[model samples]
Target: MDFSLLKEAMESNSFEKIADICDQLMLQVSAQGIKFEEDWPYTIHLLGHLYVNDVNSARFLWKTIPSVVKEKQPEVVAVWKIGQQLWMRNYSGVHEAIRGFDWSPQTQGLITAFSELYTNKMFHLLLSAYSTITVGDTALFLGMSEENATNYALQRGWTIDSVSGMLTVKKQPIVTEQKLDPSKLQRLTEYVFHLEH
Candidate 1:
């Protein structure tokens, strides 16, 4: 497999394309009858799927991985721990799995990006889904230390009750960015008028 594209994508931190690039590379390697066990970067391929939040794809990839590889490659097994945690919606487990592994340089960037994305996603979900949440739960969801999570919430304007250690989530107003252009609106209005007539 010519890994130039994959290397370039990683170097540039183009995480969104990693999954597709790895998928194409997997196909090419399979077509050439290349042995995956000897030199394949299975760690990167699996991490790419997780980076893109494609848990189902990650699960499928895990299932297709050869049993020997699964048994022999500790890194691949570690990556699947994150996938399994994600599949089960165990937020704390996901954080623990990510932090517990010392990932190689080749896969570290994707893992970091995945962690940040997961944190941001959980932050937004909390903002929308709950009015109040405990400090420990917030820390687990945000994948940070309790103090750091409390600080993060404070920075985002959420109030923390000191005694209860529960955060009062301050939901940000949703700002719609799609302003109606007058000409387009006029054109749409005219079209509707014609349709009605």
Candidate 2:
């Protein structure tokens, strides 16, 4: 897999495509019985590192699993906000990786191919309930705060930010640029200038 292309897709906020690629890779891994160790660590130290990568979103899983399993296991929930802090740190890595890439037709094609694979993998995982709930279901369970859940999804590159502060409801081609109204920009600039003066 061309990591550069994946990086570009991520930086450009091409979430539909990103989700698709992730799904496919996950499916392939499952077919081969390859677990996402980064997302599922057996040890506390490994789990902490995986959380640092933004590869594992469910901190609660690591905390609760040992107790729920009724087995004596290592507890690693020393830090209260470890997961959030690591996610913020990983966000920077993601930004740096895809800082400036041309969103060309070829790049789009590559994104789509990977996206399809990713989508498959995600579906398979969802079906299996591998660790946590499906993203959609999780969002629903979190309640009606669209912004919060949407931001969570964005971190995973699972949904694209679209017009009217809305996410595209279905998977589509990656949008490289978002169109903003010139009038709105001018007004906002004037407002800021006036405030400064």
For residues 1-197, could you state the per-residue lDDT of candidate 1 as single tens digits?
Answer: 58899999999999889889989988888899987764777788888999888999989998988888988888999999999999999998999999999998878888999899999999999999999999998998998999999999999999999999999999898888988799999999999999999
TM-scores, all models, native as reference? 0.88, 0.21
- Poorly placed runs, candidate 1 (over 4 Å): 177-197
Candidate maximizing lDDT:
1
Worst 10 residues of 1 by lDDT: 34-43
How well is each residue in 95-170 modelled by candidate 2, as lDDT tens digits? 2222223334433443343334433443444334433334445344333245665665555545543544433333
C-alpha-based local distance difference test score of model 1: 0.91
- What's the true lDDT of residue 184 in model 1? 97
